[model samples]
Target chain A: MLNRPATDTQVTHLQRLWLYVLCGLVIFFLIVPTLLVIPMSFSDSRYLDFPPESWSLRWYRAYFNSPEWLQATAVSFQVAFLTMLLATATGTLAAYGLHATRARSSRYMTVLLTLPMIIPVILLAVGIFLTFAPVGLNSTIGGLMLAHTILAIPLVMITVTAGMQNFDINQEMVARSMGASRPWAFLTVTLPQIRNSVMSGALLAFIISLDEVVIALLIAGGDKATLTRRMFLALRDEIDPTIAAISTLLIAFSVLMLTLSQILQSRK
Target chain B: MTAADHQPDAPMNERALDRQARAEQRNLMALSLPAFILVGSLVLLPMGWLFWMSIYGADGFTAENYTRLLHPSYKKTLITTFELAFLVTGLCILLGYPLAYLASQLKPRMASLVLLCVLFPFWTSLLVRTYAWLVLLQRRGLINNWLMEWGLIDTPLKLVHNFTGTTIGMVHIMLPFFVLPLYASMKTVDYDLMKAASNLGASPVRAFWQIYVPLTLSGLGAGVILVFVLSLGFYVTPALLGGGRVMMWAMQIERSMAVYADWGAASALGVVLLVMTLGILWAFARLTGAIGATEGK
Candidate 1:
């Protein structure tokens, strides 16, 4: 194709300038609040103030020292870790199974697996709360982990399935033909090829659990309160710099994990 | 003797291969079984229970919970929730499309860096993001303070704890949902087509509107459906920013369950919300499919 002459580029310059301005404003709007929290977390003031007159580590110290905050953080980590393990394992298996089987029922199963992503989260929380209340699963870490796993499974399935699509099944078949068991063949041949997707999916599941709030609000309580649930209540009940400090830490942690996942994904 | 031996063993090799295929099929079924059970019990079963609770009432089976939706107050809340969702989704498209376009036009490496700004918000917790807006938009918050110092207004704007604050917070959270899909679709567009159009003597604007814009309609459709559905179920942003003044359906469900302890009513409201969301998506998909068919022709 011929590169369009200077006339085309020149004529669109004014329009492009306006597009650039709008894009810049949108980027600023999306990023400014997240960027502001870091500075607000470090502010020496008791109240949230911008362009801090002075900075101190007091709020960070407060977050570290507070039993309630610490417990919530611990619970969040525990639930997220369990969610990562369960979702990744089940989702990876489901993806592989679906890819291997050419049955008509697999399409319907794919829809069933992805329904959690489609349904409103509030609805899920309400349903789970009602269902688990009588069974005594409410206010427990296990219940929260179960809920997070349901939410994370679809993500893992989507990611791992994308990886599975690119894999050459002939390699696994060769392994099987060499007298390897089905599981053994998969472990030796297929798993290594799709390890990146599995890792990324696990990272995503961990983040989903860590950031989950609605379900935690409905089910997780007392000693099992997740970090997000605590931050939510603190925001509602009181306005303090401690929430800011915690928010900053959460942001940093997420950024770190996401970057790590990106690196893993790009290695291939 | 060797040829005779090979011929006799062929039948045995075929049976062995058959058994292995059957074993692999069984293994595949077994591998997927746990996920099926997990999703079934935790997700599908609860959803079924929710529907059952919606219809189940004092006298045995009653529509009282659904009838409650007819009340003027409840109707208003439903209308307002949808209206808010529509407004937010519209704003997201307006702001996101240009940014997505700009990102798509950039060099590959530069595009990823620009796209990171969109993805960063997804990493941060929704509560933290909403709280960040609260801190910035409050009466004595950063925006107001900056405005005052610059002598922009006499009084602090009522930015937070209102419709304005709720909309802004939602739009901020939803912009990425719109942009990422829009950018992905745009990247796949053949810029060469635009060149072809210009070469045919069409003006630049004509080429863009007649060629490029039509190509992006599918992305536009996808982004609209995604943002609209997600926004309809939004609870945290509106609750925190609206300060109980603005009530969406999700908050209503919360109140019904937590405050009133009315399981039937809460479940009924949830069913309505779910049905409406699914119905809208189904309609959107049909509409887009028709549009795509016509465009192909």
Candidate 2:
């Protein structure tokens, strides 16, 4: 974007003022709705409002004290953690495999593995529900973990594959030639170089599982319901400001994970 | 170097080398096995069942499941879904293009701030954002209250639980999807061409329209296809905000399964949605590939 002569910088900036203002509104529209609930969550009243006249942690207390909310939160974290591990390991392997194999079949294999992401969740959820029912895994924690891992893998594959573009396979091959095992060469020579993307992909996998709703809505039930599923059910009943408190916490958590990923990505 | 490129030292060594190379290829391919097994069981196997259910009936294989889609109720929902998808995609284009254009033109640090703002809502829970809109656009919600307080209206407007609410929420959700891809493509474009045109006596507007805009069209097309496909299968925002007034395709699919408990109906609807989504993506890929081939020629 190197443009405009040094003498023309001020003129061009001034000329683009209207464009900036328009974009500013678009950015406001993008972010404000999500951020507004942070304050609304602390309201003394039960309903959501902007710039509360009086502030209290009534809703936060409601979220923390409720056993149901706590249980769902615990379930979400456990499932998400397991999903992150499952998805990252498998997806990273698949990405490396795709990069390693010069075979034409790898192209079709890539599409086959990533198909879950493109298909509608409702269909996947229903299919997963039926799939799990026969195995007696429906409504169980393992079922949720497996379903989410599939959804999360495509993202990991995508990010790790993008990261692999900057790397050379010959380095790993050279290490292998120098009396190192294949896994050893990859772990010692390749993984360190691509660790940033792997870490970012892991974080992404964690968040996708944590935030997924449709599958959880269909397949997760009983005491194992996810936080998102619970919040969704709660919202349908009413706009209890308790959910606003929970949303604020979730928004904060997403920000933290994204920041961590950014740090990992930006670091040398 | 590959084993194939190695010098033929001895016949026994050569056979061992070939075997080692084959083993290495197999081992590399083996790495993808876990993902294949996991996804295949849950996603692919279930999809096969969905196709079967769509055709299967109590008596035998039947076409009634798909034929049911011809009902006026289903037809209405199908029409509404396409309309909403188009409306949201158009709104995203109108809003996303300028923001991406501006972001591409800014300093690197400034551009990141703009991108972060775009990505914030995306990272947040889909349900939370839909809830935010549900609160803001509802009767006696903030927007309606503001308009009344400012004397712009005598009463709170019906801003939500309807088509308007769904559109606003969907657009908010889809905007980042449109902008990020557009911004990436725009960043790769050389703006020096536009400056050269300006120097060569073309008007700024003409240069932008003829040169710069054409360069960004591929990005625009990508954003358009992505938003449209996503919107077609969207369920969360519409369900949370539509108040049962709007019956989009995904909502219909959910209703068939959840309300009617009809696997055949749900599977049939899901099959159509999947086909449309995949069909559009396949067509777009070919269209872009064709354009690239012609340009290369």
Candidate 3:
């Protein structure tokens, strides 16, 4: 693309070097903060001091031994599990329906399903808190799961719909025209074809629920607090290395899930 | 075995196939019902409740909550929200554009590896990322310690708990959102166009600005709208890094609810935010002549 091969070699070389250096700095800025926490979490100091004079696993031990932290972890896992199941089921079904029907309203439905993602979480938190309080659903595990499922469904829908785009519905039709029942054809044929999408969607839903905090802060309380909500409170009230330890673990889990999803997508 | 026997069953088979097709369509529509009901009852109903609470007063329906928005402090919060969003969005564009250009120019494999820098932060938890900034930007933080150790200054810089700190943290979070779209669009620009422009005696920089930059405007616009909207509603990063000095709309709604216990006021602020967001999206769609641009996220 550099057509001025004779006259501009020196200047172009300098420009290329400058571009590389600038991008290298930007990449460093993006990833260093996240990477620094792993070391900080292992620091032996009571306060956050980078390049600790000493290193220890004291914060990891604290995270493990504290009942409240363990309980919050458990609540996060439970909510994430339920959200994965609910969102995957509902979202996959909707994707299939929308793909098959090809109705005019499908566009509107897609927009509606995506609203939870587009709208601010704080607004939804306020809305849910007000609506659920009178119905006695606030602070309950069910309430948190419901809110998370709403958030996760759109992601699942998008993934599954993309998967369906590559799927040929005629295969299912042929299976049905033979001897298989509708449900059987879907289970044995369509479901297997889109299994990767469904799995990735479930993983994404799990991650979303695990990381969600704002709604959990406004609605979840007492024994049902999510790990992130607890982390938020901890940061506000005190600076603890235990929070750092948990952050490291959460980061590791997210990296693992994202890598797994990438592998799943690549295999297809 | 005979033509007559086949002829007798042909119409029956065709009718059965028609019935089956209708059933399948109905079944497909039925399959979507569970998700529809869930969204309607949980998401839509609660949003309606929010709107209702905004207008509902102690005695009857009223616009008092919205009129309260005209007050000076509330107006300041709204203006600050937009200003902060624009500042973060502008920084993302300025920083992200070059990085995206760099990536777009590289070989595909190396480009993705560089893009991973952006994606890693995207995949990480917002709270964790924000907390990392908190650790690095606080009064006794890493940056300050390094600066002081180098004898640059005796006192630690007050980086955290203010507008500067909040902007830094937010830009860190929002950088990838801008880069991914911008890079995707940049990759689609034909490099041969630049080559042709240069062959016509245009300098490389002139070719880039005149040809390449114009081609990337769609992606740039999409990225701007996305980062702006997301930053407008940001709650966590500012709350953690702002040290109570920076106030955005999301935090205001939280304060109205938690501190003031004024649902009407909170809901009213929420409605205003929602309207503003939708208005921006609608205006972008009108300007772009497509809704696809607004779906950048």
Candidate 4:
């Protein structure tokens, strides 16, 4: 009402009140579930009591002290870091290839590359687990990285392909016309221009691996447990404040990564 | 040379240039081969192996696992899965349409703020959001606690560990997937069309029905299909929140392997899911030619 021109105020002012109230409730439903956990993390009770009568950081202390939780957290970071590197290297190459090629097969190649994302994660997890079981690769660090890298490839490819849209391919052609090699032209001219999106894709790749739950559940277990795997099992058994603490940390880390990725994409 | 120079009869050494272009395409495609191989061996190869697993039983080649899908229990699971999918998709549309409309009408900066709020849960770990709901809706949990204190009810409602709990959690996860695309489509509508209708002796409600609603129908259809398709294969939310009563399709596959250790049954279930998910996506792509809208989901 305040923002609109004075002449039209009477039209929307009273009539829109119902719309505003309805939307406010829906928006509250959307945002509150995520923020609800933040207060629960500070609870001093054994169970997750909201609007707690007491408060402390003891769950955070519990998480820091437990070897199992710490080990799971470390494994998640290690796998996510490795997945980031591998997916970025291969996926960036694939995106560049898709951008450069004029062949009709390029469309089919795109469909194949993106199939990982379109297929349900449970199906992929089951397949990977079955394939890995016989070779003793299931629950291993390398297997999880391979599984996660497949999922992350489409994300990296999507961002980098979008990034290449603003770039003039003619600039690279000019570099090549001056006797520079294709690889040399790309390294010197194209990489610097699209580095932000590549970096953003890398960040997204990291986040995807860290928060992955289904694949980790089937293929990751025992000492190879990822943070989400442990959290899922823990939640199935109980709802302790320690899990809340870990959840809070995971939420904070993903928010940071997503914000950084968004900033990177928006900049270029 | 311009693009026309590449035409067969218009250019110098046209066939030679065509050959060179084809060679260049292959060379560039070599860059993608490693990623291609990774996805193929990891996804396609295992999926083929699963297909092989499905067709075999203890004796030799057999259709026992596929035949087992005809049993009453399997039918119940399939029916339950589709029913839940319908229910969740319906609720999402009811809640999502209003929220998306509100966001679309806001100023650019304010709309993004609303979008950021919607995406906050999307960015959070799925498990965290499910856990938050579990805590809030459990019998001894916050919602029940508050309800009792307010004297709104004589007893705490059975919110969790049932069908209701699963629906709530699934709707929360699927809401953003519906809203983002619908909002994008909504932004492209010409508000002038509605105003012009009002000026032409139409009431406000008539203008909304005649002009505004038709413009947004395609977005609504897209959102409905995406939500229903996604809900068919839900695993985590239903498994955790439903607490074994729901028996969704994905959980059925998981149970066949985990509880019964029946590779044949599990493999068969996995194959069916893959077929259904891809089939729907392909059919939708063919019908609407908007496969690009499936991005980010």
Give me the candidate number with maximum TM-score. Answer: 2
DockQ score for candidate 2: 0.61
lDDT of 4 by residue, B1-297 (tens): 877766766565777898898889999999999999999988999999999999977799999999999999999999999999999999999999988988998888889888988877777889888988988899988889999999998799999989999999999999998998899889899987876886787877787778877788779878888898889988999988998799999999988888898999999999998898889888877766554455325
Docking class of 4: medium
- What digit string (tens of lDDT, one per residue) describes model 1 on residues A1-268? 1232333323454545677688888888988888899998989998667778888999999999999999999999999999999999999999899888766678888888888888889998988887788999999988898899989999999999988888998898899888997789899899999999999999999999999989999999889998889888887776777988988988899789879977987875
- Docking category of candidate 3: medium
DockQ, all models:
0.62, 0.61, 0.56, 0.62
| Second chain TM-score, each model | 0.90, 0.94, 0.88, 0.89
Better of 1 and 3 by DockQ: 1
Summarize candidate 4's per-residue lDDT along A15-83 as a digit string, tens digits.
577777888888888778777888889989887688977999989999999999999999999999999
Relative to the true structure, candidate 1 has a C-alpha RMSD (angstroms) of 3.0
Error of 3 at A40 (Å): 1.4
lDDT of 1 at A146: 87
Model 1, B1-297: lDDT tens per residue? 788878988999999998877776777866777788878887799888888888987789989889988999898898889899999989998898889877998878988888888989988888889989999999989999999999999899999888899999999989888988899899899888888888899888898789888889889889989999998988889989998788899999988998999888899999998998889888997998898798789
lDDT of 2 by residue, B1-297 (tens): 777766565687989998987877777888999999999999888888989989988899999999889999998998999999999999999999999998997889998888888877777889889888887888978898889989999978888888999999999999999998999999998867877787788776688788888899899999999899989998888888888898889988888888899889999998899899999999999999999998899
Model 2 Cα lDDT, one tens digit per residue, A204-224: 999999989889988899999
Clash pairs for candidate 3? none
Please write out the lDDT profile of model 3 over residues B13-96, one tens digit for every residue. Answer: 999998877776777777878888877877788888889989988889999999988999988888888889999999998889
* Per-residue error (Å), model 3, residue A182: 3.4
Q: Looking at model 1 chain A, which ten-residue stretch has the lowest summed lDDT?
A: A1-10
